[model samples]
Target: MRLYWVILCLVYSGSAVSDQKVYRWKDKNGNWVYSDVPKKGSEKVKLSTNMLTMPATDTSILTPNPATPTVTYQAKITAPSDQQTLRENSGSVYVNGLVTPRFANGFQVQLFLNGKATGPKQTTASFALRDVPRGEHKLQMKVFNDKGMLVAQSAVTTFFLHRASLLNR
Candidate 1:
């Protein structure tokens, strides 16, 4: 029994040690090097042969539901974080907010500026505060589903940025 146990332990240890992964690639000058650390000028890497490849399976399990029911959420800037009032010569002002129902790959987000629909309505979206006459202004965001229907609207939040006009005070 003692001899059998020793052999089993050695076999397991050998397998584990052999499973370390290494990267492979050829350098820019067309010489090949196989070091665990990526060489200085290599652009692509091939993984080691000992790495396990998962057996191919039906792909449906990897797909997202197309008819997945849409979800909606309301985001607010919350109290002191919201109110900002600024000046006229500041060129363009930047307004920002955290968007909601973070999509798996952020594939269904949209943004609006000053009540005007801006852009083609994109996912992973952020909007710039632009072309306001200054003094005081409001910022808002609208997030939507892939189907173009309004799914969520952010609370109409306010903020301020001062150009030289207001800063001289």
Candidate 2:
């Protein structure tokens, strides 16, 4: 009987020491946050309240699941033409009116210089090229949904800027 009691104590003690991991991070607003270690900056948090057990009743019944959000389409991209040609070291280049889908919520245009991504710009259906360096500049336009996911990618547009003529110099 004494041996049986000792065995039960050993089993209970073994189960009591289980550990769980969590992570911590700060948001753009500078608030501290915590999540599992797989999350960014999770190493700073000490584990707390690992073995809590709750009655298995439906707590979610009080709160309804949010309806799957629907995304509305907007203009796609590349109006007049998907491609353009320009001169090297030429001042600002213009990429005129790209088409947007009829039902689009908004448009995001990403510009690439040469082959590198410059950045993204938000507009209705048009984008202007500014301060393009001299040489072959490749411009690409991608359209996105209101949720900021790409819906369409326009054909790569190539433009060239010719060296200024001596006559002009």
Candidate 3:
């Protein structure tokens, strides 16, 4: 394997160095061989001088512009208004929220129930909570930037969940 790489290097370098001579011959094992040194029964090989190259890239496009100001976001819970009561036998709740000045790209939303984060962060402003125990709960929505920094948060909205009891069935 080492010999194969050595021969390949010689062949490729020979093409780049036009002044160097390359020789090709078949060894006793019936395998074609390439080398910079000429051997008995070897023939001189001509390599093409043409090579492909790409222009240097402009790095200015990769850097962010410092003049653009960062946007400030405000989040609000639009559904399940504060102090509202929800009735669901399955304890499921649907939450909806909105962001002022439009939600930007690379931003995410997270829902907090009773001061604890629920479910994964999402790009949309809506969330579906399941299997919540019947009782009072606090809900809040927070917005995060691409860097995972907290950008905005909604005022805590208090609500009550009521579920049908089996004894009342």
Question: What is the C-alpha RMSD, rounded to one decimal, of candidate 1?
Answer: 20.0
**Which has the higher TM-score value, candidate number 1 or candidate number 3?**
3
lDDT of 1: 0.61
- Candidate 3: the clashing residue pairs are none
2 against 3, candidate with superior TM-score: 3
Candidate models: Cα lDDT each: 0.61, 0.60, 0.93
Q: Mark the regions of model 1 whose C-alpha exceeds 4 Å error after superposition.
A: 1-70, 76-80, 86-88, 104-107, 165-169
lDDT of model 1, residue 101: 51
For residues 1-169, could you state the per-residue lDDT of candidate 1 as single tens digits?
9999999998888787666555567767977777666656654454454746799889997889899986666644433246756554745765455655564444455555556665666664455545656455566667665566666777776666556654567
C-alpha-based local distance difference test score of model 3: 0.93
Which is the leading candidate under TM-score? 3
Relative to the true structure, candidate 1 reaches a TM of 0.44
TM-score each candidate: 0.44, 0.43, 0.59
Q: Please state every model's RMSD to the true fold in angstroms.
A: 20.0, 18.4, 8.4
Q: Which sequence of candidate numbers ranks them by TM-score, best first?
A: 3, 1, 2
